[model samples]
Target: MAKNMTLLWCTGSCPCWRAMIALEEKNLQGYNHQLLSFDKMEHKSQQVLDINPRGQFPTFKHGDNVVNESYAICFYLESQFKSQGNKLIPDGPEEQALMYQRMFEGLTFYDKLGNVIYYDWYVPEGERHDSALKRNKDALVAELGLWEGYLSKQGSGSFLAGKTFSLADVVVFPTVAFLFRFGLSAGRYPKLEEYYALLKDRPSIKASRPPHWLEGPEEELLLKEI
Candidate 1:
């Protein structure tokens, strides 16, 4: 039985955005959405902490069952609602395995990018380490190049896993969007640019894009080389 779904999340959180996109793909009826704010420390409120001990923004609940962590929530939704809405995982074991592999690879890219965001961009200017920042940024560029190469190698396909959009796209699209949010040039990586352009206007993507992003200033967190 598909119980009612509820998601507790903050705006502009990449992980939260991932869950939102997944839910959008699922297109479940009678779901609950509570949009909290990190600025107000709403995630740490007693109610949120009770459901998620870590006070994370992307906590989800299906009836009485609580699940934290973004990807887990996405996987759970895809598995439980296999027959509903869009088919994210796709059919066949080989295809499912490939999708899982690419999804984790997307996380690797997210981690590499986070190294720069956490150490270089988020850290205060006085405490920031120039050498470490450059190292992390260089690593991030390398990660971007990796995806660029992967897309190029995949040939004429518009998606990471192939012709159709799948969970791999759900997991990776936000990371690429985040990179663009930080001002990475869409033009530099033509394949990636094409991919982003396609996904950007997707109904799910547009509906789930961070609300604050529509009203906030653009973050220029990367080097001009992007």
Candidate 2:
């Protein structure tokens, strides 16, 4: 619709980045993007909470529709703007089902890894749990290899969805980022290493990488190598 519509951003979070990746891919740039500071708890400000009751980041205000959850937000942007640019969610039941399946798998299969990483490492050392972190790391190792094996046998290049970048790519990038943030590297994980090179170098990825990716101890200690 109008260029005046604002896309509020927060701390370069993965969920937020999904909408951004789609927007940049389709050349839907230059919408008023306001950056919020997670460090300052700006996302919880009344203005943000009004837009999203859950008070989460990645909340989008597109005309009258208020959207939350990364997957839903990305889906809305893709469908509403489908006529405009490169199609992200392609037509056909097989592709649609595969997209939905992979997206769901990301939440169910991968979110556990993300949560453990967050509690273990992202929570700061004094408050972190060493036991939970180790257990989570072990589980993630097993699961990540599962993805590597799947991709190897699937007859594809980098992505889970074959050639083109799709919802799968959007779903996967942040988890990989999160994994790496705690000193986990794709090199140790094999398939992720290959996928990391492929996904991180995308034009949109280049455009929207979160600032913290380069600034903090997590950036230096975890994400830099990935």
Candidate 3:
């Protein structure tokens, strides 16, 4: 039986986007989500804070167990709903290791790019530092190179870890899609252009692509569309 589960989520945030993609990939159907509002500070209210004292969105509530971190929440969903569609991480050591390795590498890119993308785009002009932006962009460039190398070696045939579409694809593709479509795209990388184009065609991703909105009802609807 599917547990009575609900995700306290955020729209437009990369971390929340990750959870959405993970849920789709696993095909763990039927659970609803409560999309919280950052503008209204709903995440900090007593209702949400009671479940997640850290006041973070994309928090997962499964009966008594609560998961806060995006990555950990995905893991928890996969573990609890193991009988669902796709296995984000396989059971065998060798196979599971490959999934973890690519997924973790994807997280590294999230960290490197997040510093610039989140701060430069979101932070107030006065609060954002030029030096920090440059350094973070540089780090993202380096990480992109690493991804290019990995793709050239592995993402050629079907997926990142060779033949099977695993957690890595779910974790990496959305950011890649955003980067290419809106932001830098292919400022410094050639291999990524071809790779991302192919990945954007994935049905799960195409179905999950969020619509743009400012805040409140419109933004909440966009997230539910995913």
- 1-226: candidate 1 lDDT, tens digit per residue: 2347888899878899888888888887457888988889999998799999999889889988888888998899888888888989768776677788889998899888788766644777798777887888888888889889888877765577777789899989998888877778777878787778889989999999999888975766564465
- In terms of lDDT, the best-performing candidate is 1
Instruction: Give the clashing pairs for model 2.
Output: none
Tens-place lDDT per residue, model 2, 1-226, is: 3474566678647788877877777667877778888778878888788888887787677778877777887787788778776778757777677777777777755666665645544576687776876676667667777777766765546466656678777776777666666676655676666677677878887788887777874633532332
Select the stronger candidate by TM-score from 2 and 3. 2
lDDT by candidate, in order shown? 0.83, 0.71, 0.70
Candidate order, lDDT descending: 1, 2, 3
**Per-residue accuracy of model 3 over 1-226 as CA lDDT, tens digit each:** 3347777776666677777777777775566677778778888888788888898787777777888787887787778768887876766777678778888888887777667556645777888778877777777778887888877776455577656777777777766765654445464566777777776767666655654422322321211111
Error of 1 at 76 (Å): 0.4
TM-score of 3: 0.80
Clashes of each: 0, 0, 0
**What ranking of all candidate models by TM-score puts the best one first?**
1, 2, 3
Q: Can you tell me which runs of candidate 2 are displaced by over 4 Å?
A: 1-4, 120-131, 216-226
